[model samples]
Target: MDYHLYPLGDQGVLIELGEDINLKVHERVKSVSAHLEKMNWDWVIEYVPAFASVAIHYDPMKVMEKEGDSSLYAYEIVCAYVEKELEKITPSHSEAPRTVEIPVCYGGEFGPDLAYVAESNDISEEKVIDLHVGGDYLVYMIGFAPGFPYIGGMPEEIATPRRKEPRLQISAGSVGIAGKQTGVYPIETPGGWQLIGQTPKALFRPENEIPSLLQAGDKINFKPITREEFDAYKEEEK
Candidate 1:
């Protein structure tokens, strides 16, 4: 796998693996994470993984001291290790994606843009639902908003680009399309993605043990649920 490692904000290193958001890239994410954890690097505070890259945070003082250099030799040290370790991935370092289920209410009040999306794609609303729920999506990375999974695997026919005029406030659970991708809103935030169906599920709640509904490299399957079921879930929450 081709990769590029760069120094960022003193102790941070950004590693770009590839351009495509697919299973292959997701595997690379897991591989890199494991490799980093096993390495005896000095004072790595955090490792943030995204769609095509990994951003590593470290303590500059500790790293420089350990490497016996006044300059940023620590960055070079880590980069060398990463480049050496990422050699076609060994059998022991095989990547695996975790599967997650999200139940959604397709049309009417829940999906305000359902008709619009259907109209844009030249298909019936029912077909739109089928096309949407049919694919198994991958969580490339979480960005744009907290716990907002940057999901991939939308059908080519219904990959509607973001709205020319974005909504002022898209409520939590609002599922949307932006260019070639689709995702759900973890919190109410202004966004340009074409709003379609919604899931009653709590995408992010700090109270839960797992605060983030979707993590990077997660596999997602959208299951169509009834409005009544959604209402019941809300009622139960109350």
Candidate 2:
């Protein structure tokens, strides 16, 4: 219930709901964001919600114009309104998270770090795949790469830390794990997470109405597929 509001340069206001990254904090973050989006306040230009905070971008000129008392600053006006509004917002739990299934071809050439991950965990490659697929992860936020999801809910049994050395280039659709999190690489980019599999589905497409396949508050499940099936899925996309 405790929160803090801070200004970001001249255009953005960041709301910190809690100090730690947890489900309860995210719930508060999402609630505030949902309320902000609905209000569509004249000064608010955009909303960027993360695990424990939400950044609200606004027009400084518009905010200043609306405040009749020139003595009141832009950030002050925004902070007051946000604090008052948030006090009345009751977090909604009616909505069930949308689940998306991703098909992955594990090990071999597709996942260069698969062996390392298995050995590090003292588990067989098949067991590693099982643990990865068994998770029902929640999409906490999207960043790092376009449509790159930072997901949570991986079992502790399979938790693996990030690689000491990052790869110069990782292929799109590559699935990787770091610490207690798992995510898919939306595009070819340098990364340090341990690669476990690759998915054929495009996580980000500029032409699509919804450019990012995943969104915050959604859930994901990994499905293990054969190497041949992976090839077929890739071909079908063409």
Which candidate should be chosen as best, given lDDT against the real structure? Answer: 2
How well does model 1 score by local distance difference test? Answer: 0.80
- Model 1: per-residue Cα lDDT at residue 93: 32
Clashing pairs in model 2, backbone N/Cα/C closer than 3 A: none
Clashes of each: 0, 0
Task: Write down the lDDT that model 2 would get.
Answer: 0.88
Tens digits of lDDT, candidate 1, 123-194: 998988899999778888887777989888888888887788888898899888777788999998887877
lDDT by residue for model 2 (1-238), tens? 6788888888889988888877888788878888889987988888998888999999989999889676888888888888889889887767788999899999888899999988988999999899888887888888777898889888877788999999999999999889888889999999898998899999998899879999888899899999999999999998
Question: Which runs of model 2 end up more than 4 angstroms from their true locations?
Answer: 68-70
Candidate with maximal TM-score: 2
Runs of candidate 1 exceeding 4 Å displacement: 38-42, 68-72, 80-96, 208-210
* TM-score against truth, every candidate: 0.88, 0.94
RMSD of each: 2.5, 1.5
Model 1 TM-score? 0.88
